[model samples]
Target: MSTPTLLTGRDPRSESALLLLSAASGAADAFVFICVGQVFAGVMTGNLVLLGASAAGVGEHGVALRVINALVSYSFGVMCCAWMSERLRWPLPVMLLIEVALLATGAVLWALDLITSDGDRLGLLVLIAVAMGIQGRIRATPTNYFTGTLTSLVSRVTLRSRDQGDSWVAGRLIAVVAGAAVTALSVRFWPGAAAMAAVVPAAGALLVESVPRRTSRG
Candidate 1:
C-alpha cells in the first residue's frame, strides 16, 4: 500500500481547517491538565514522562492512573482510526465527525456536572484523548505539538524559501498558544463552560472539511 498523503496537499481551506483543529487540541490539553488532572489529552510524549514521574512517586493522587488511562485509550483510538481509515478510505469529514461526537460528549458531561468522581474524570479524559488521537491521525500534522513545529519553522524562516508557507505555520502556532491561554482562563473561572469553548474549534474544523474543494481547469 502507498503511504498516506497526510500533509502534502496544501490549500487555503485545508490550512484553515488544520489551524482550527490545532486550536481545539491546545484548548483540550489545557482544560484537561488544569480542570481534570495534570495529564495531557493529546500530547502522548508528555504523558509518557508524566507517567514515569507518577510511577516514581512524584505527583499528586491518582496521577498514575490518569496517565495510564490516557496512554491506553489514545493507543486504542489510534488503532481504531487506522483501521477505519484503511477500510473506509479515510474520509476527512467522517474522521472529523467522530472527533466532534467524542468532544461533544465530553462537553455535555462537563456542562451537566457529571464528572464528580475520579473514574468519571478519567473517563472524560480518555474520551478527549481518543478524540485527539483520531484527529492527530487524520491530519498527521505537527499542529497539536507546536513546540517542535515552531522550532523547525523558525529555523526555516532564516533561510527564505520560494514558497513562504512559514506564515501559515506561524499563524497555527499563535492559534494554539492563544487557544490554550483562553481555555486555561476559562477553566479557572468557569470550569464547566470551558469544555464548550473547547468544542468550538473542532466544530469549525468539521465545517471546513465539509465544504467541497474547487479544482482548477488545465
Candidate 2:
C-alpha cells in the first residue's frame, strides 16, 4: 500500500498500530528497570551511560555486565528483524508477532516464578532487551515516519503540520508513559501477571496491524 498522506487523508489503522507498539516499548522498559534490573530494555542511551558510570567505578555490583549483555542482546534482535524481514518477506504484523511471542514467554516465566535467581535474571533481561530491540527497529527499517532520532521526528512532524497540514505525529511519548504507569500498577497489584500483562499493547498492535486496510471508492 502507498504511504497515506494525512494532508488529504489519514491511515488511523496504521497509526494506531504504531502507537500501540510505542506503548509496548514503554511497558517493556519499565518492566525491565523496575523488576529485572536498572538497565532499560529499549533506551540504549541509559544503558550506555550506566556502563560508563560503571567504568568510572560508581555503579551497582553487576551493572556493567548486565548493561553490556542487554546492549548486545538488543542488537541481536535488531539484526534478526532486519535480516529475517528481508529474507522471509513477511508482513509487518508477522515480524511483530515474533516480538510479542518473546515478550509473552518472559511474562510466563515471571508469572510461574521461574525467574528467581541471577541466571534467571540474565535470561529475562536478554528476552526483554531482544524484544525491545525488535520494537526499536521494526518502525525505523520500514517505509514509515518512525525515525531513530527524536529531533528528526519532531522536525518532520512540525514541517508536515505547517506545510501539508498533515495530522500531528503519533503521541508516542505519551503512550510510553501510559504503558509504564499501567505496568507499574500491574506489578504492584497483580504481580503474577505483571510481566505478561505489560505486553498487552504489543499484542494489541499485532492485532491492529493484521486488520485489512480500508479502500476508498472513486
Candidate 3:
C-alpha cells in the first residue's frame, strides 16, 4: 500500500465532528423530503418513531415500514460508496451520478403520484437513503450529509474545550451550520433536485482539494 499523506491524518475527534456535521446537514434536508416530498431521505429517527407506533398497532404502520426501507437503502448507498471508493481512483463522479439518478427518479415519482401511500413513500425513502449513504463516504471525512446520524454534532459542540484553540475547529463548525442551513432551504423550497444541486458544487470542491486547508503553523 502507498503511504498516506498528512491530509489523511484525521484526528478522531475531528473526524467524528465532520461525520456528525455531514449527518446533521443531510438529515435536515431529508426532513423536507419526508415531510413534503413524501419520501424518507435521511434521519431514520422519524421512521423509527413511526415504526414504534406501528409495532403498537398504531394508525399508520406503513410509515414505520417505509422508514425501515429507507434505513436499508441508506445502508446500501454507503456500501456502494465504500466499494466505489476502493475500486475507482476517482469516486466523486460515480457518486454524483448515483445521486442525480435517484433525485430524478424521485421527481418523477412525486409528479406521478406514485409516492402517495406508505408503501410508495417507503420506496422513495429507500432511494433517498441510498443516495445519502453514497454521500456519507465521499472523503476521508464525510463531506455530504448522511442524515442517519447527526447527534454527534450536538455533543461535540457542547463538549468543554481546554482553551479557545485555533480558529480551525471553529471555522469547521461554522461551515457545518452554513451548509445545513443552505441544504434546509433548498430541500424546503426546491426539493431533492435543488438540494442535490446545492451540494454538487461543494462536492466538486471537496473532490478537487484532497485536504482541507488549515492555518499555517508558526
Candidate 4:
C-alpha cells in the first residue's frame, strides 16, 4: 500500500488549531522571561508597592503613570487577541504578527534610546505589560502561574501532582523549568534581544502548521 501524502492549505479551522498551539507554547516561554525579568528588575513588586502607596495618598505621580501605562499595555495585548477573533477566522497568525510587531517596535525604541536613559518609563511599562498579558492568557492547561507568577505555579504544581494524580503533571512541571532555563540562558547571552528572539519560533510555528485544509479533511 502506498503511504498517503499530507496536503496543506490555509484552512480556518486548521489554522486556528495550529495557531492556538503556537500561541500556547510561545506564551509559556514568554511567561518565563517576563517573570524572570520582572523579578530581576523589581518591576512586579514595585507595581504592588506603587498601588499601595497610591491608595495611601503618598504615591508619586510616577507610580500612577506606570500603573496606567501597564493597564494600557495589557489592554492593547488583549485587544490584539480580540481583533484577531473578530476579523480573522484563524486568529493565531494575527496574534503572532502583533507579537512580532511589538517586539520589533520595542527593538526600534531601544535602539533609539527610547527606553534606556531618561526614557519614557510609562511607554516601556506599557509595552512589557501588553506582551505579558498576551502570554499569560495562552495556556494549554492551567495549573499555576496563571499570570506568570512562578510562586503560584510552584504551589499549584505541588497541589495538582498530589490531588489530581495526573501523570502529565511531571512533564508540565519540567516544561516550566525548561522554559525558565531557556529564558535565563537567553537573557545572559543576548540580554533584551533574547525576548525578541522568542517571537521567531512562535511566528514560524503558526506559519508552518496553519494548513487550512486540516479542518476539512475529516
Candidate 5:
C-alpha cells in the first residue's frame, strides 16, 4: 500500500477543511485565553514569548506555569498523534474524533463551572492544547497558527499578483479572524455557549471528510 497524502493536498474539499480547522483554532484560542487566563491554546509561539517574559520577570504571576503546561501538553498531544498516524490507517478521522472528544470534555467542564481551581483550569488548557496540537499536524494547510501562514502569504503575493496562494491564504486569514470574533463575542456574553461553539467547526470538518467523492468512469 502507498502512503497517504493527508496534508499537501490541493483539492477544494481540502481547502474547505483547512478553513474550518482554522476557524476552530481561532475559536479555541479565544475561548482558552478569555476563560482560562491569558494563555493561548494553539499559538505556541506566543506561549513561548510569554514563557520568556515570565523568565525575565516581566509577565503576570502564574503566566509561566500556564505556558509550561500548554507546551508540555501540546508536545504530548503531537507525539501521540504522530505515533497514531504512523500506525493507524484512518489517522485523519481518528485524530479529528480525538480532538472532538477533548473539546467536548472541556466544554462540559466549563459549563459545569468546574474550572475554578488552577488544577481544574490546567486540565481544560491541556485538552485545548492537545486538540490544537493534533489539528496543527492534521491539516494540509496551515490552520492552528497564523504567523507562518502570513509569512508564506506575503511571499506568495509578492512573487505573484493573482494566484491560488493569494486566495488560499487570504481566505484562511479571514476565516480565522471571523471565528475568533464570533467566539470572543459569545464568550463575553455566554462562556458556556462559547465552549460548545468551538466544537462546531471541527465537527463540520469531519462531516466534510465523511462525504464520498465521485470518481470519473473511463
Candidate 6:
C-alpha cells in the first residue's frame, strides 16, 4: 500500500465542493446536450465526432457550426482562466465566481425563454461551453478536474491529500450521475429550469471554496 497522507490535513468542505463541482459538470453537459443542442458542451471527443459527421454532410451543417462554437468558446474560457489563475494570481474562489456568473447567465436565458430562435442556440452553446471550460480550470487538490470525463477518471485516481479508495471514485461517479439525473428530470418535466441544474451546484461550489477552513492545534 502507498503511504497515506495525513488525514488531519484533509478538509471535508473541500471534498463536498469537489462533489458539487462534479455534479455541476454533469448537469451542464446534460442540459447542453438536450436543450441547447444535440452536441456536448464539455465532452470534446463526442463533439469532434459530431463535427466530422457534419463535414461529411451526415447531418445538418448548422449542427456542425454549433459544435464549432462550443469548441471555440470552451477553448477561450480555458485559456483565459488558466492565464488569470496561473499568471495573474487569481484565487480559486474568484475563479469559481466567474464560472458561476457564466452558468447563471445561461440559466437566466433559459428561464426567460430567450433561447427559442435558431440564432439563439449558438449563443446558449457558447455560454454553457465556456462555463464548463472555466469549471475545468479550477485549481484545487482532490477536486479531480478529470471528473469531466468518466472514461479517464477511473484510470487515474490519485489524490493529493488522501489514500486511494473505492469510495473516492464511487463518490464522484455518483455525484456525476446524481447531477445528470437531476438535469434530465428537470429538462423532461420542468424544461424552463433546464440550465438551472448546473447553476445552483456551481454556486454551491463557489461558496464552499470561499469559506476559510477552521484550524485546530494538534
Scored by TM-score, the top model is 5
Give TM per candidate.
0.92, 0.83, 0.56, 0.53, 0.93, 0.83
Between the candidate structures 3 and 4, which one is better when assessed by lDDT?
3
lDDT tens string, model 1, 1-218? 65443533287787898788889988989889988899999999999999888887899888988988988888887888888887767677888889889999999999999999988999999999999888777775675777788778867767755256777888888888877988978887887789876689989988988877787899
Better of 5 and 6 by TM-score: 5
* Order of the predicted models by lDDT, top scorer first: 1, 5, 6, 2, 3, 4
RMSD of 3: 6.3
| Residue 40 miss distance in model 3 (angstroms) | 4.5
> Candidate 5's residue-wise lDDT over 1-218, tens digit each?
55544755387887888888888888999888888878898899999999988888886679899999999988888887877776665557777889888998898888888788988888899999999888877766778888887887787778875575568678889989888887889987886788876788988887787677788999
In candidate 1, where is summed lDDT lowest over 10 consecutive residues? 1-10
Q: Is candidate 3 or candidate 5 better by lDDT?
A: 5
Query: For model 2, how does the per-residue alpha-carbon lDDT over 1-218 read when each residue is reduced to its tens digit?
Result: 34322111145676676667777887888888889878888788888999999998997789898899999998999898877666655567777889999999999999999998988999999999898877766774221123443565677777774333223243665676778888899889997877865579889988887777678899
What lDDT does the true structure give each of the candidates? Answer: 0.83, 0.75, 0.52, 0.45, 0.83, 0.76
**Between which residue pairs do clashes occur in model 1?**
none
Report clashes for each candidate as comma-separated counts. Answer: 0, 0, 2, 3, 0, 0
Task: For candidate 4, list the clashing residue pairs, or say none.
Answer: 9-212, 10-212, 11-212
Candidate 4 matches the true fold with a TM-score of 0.53
Please give the lDDT score at residue 65 for candidate 4. Answer: 53
Which ten contiguous residues of candidate 3 have the minimum total lDDT?
A: 1-10
Tell me each candidate's RMSD, in Å, in order: 2.1, 4.5, 6.3, 8.7, 1.6, 5.8
Candidate no. 5 TM-score: 0.93
Deviation from native of the Cα of residue 92 in model 5, angstroms = 1.3
Model 6 RMSD vs true structure: 5.8
Candidate 1 has what TM-score? 0.92
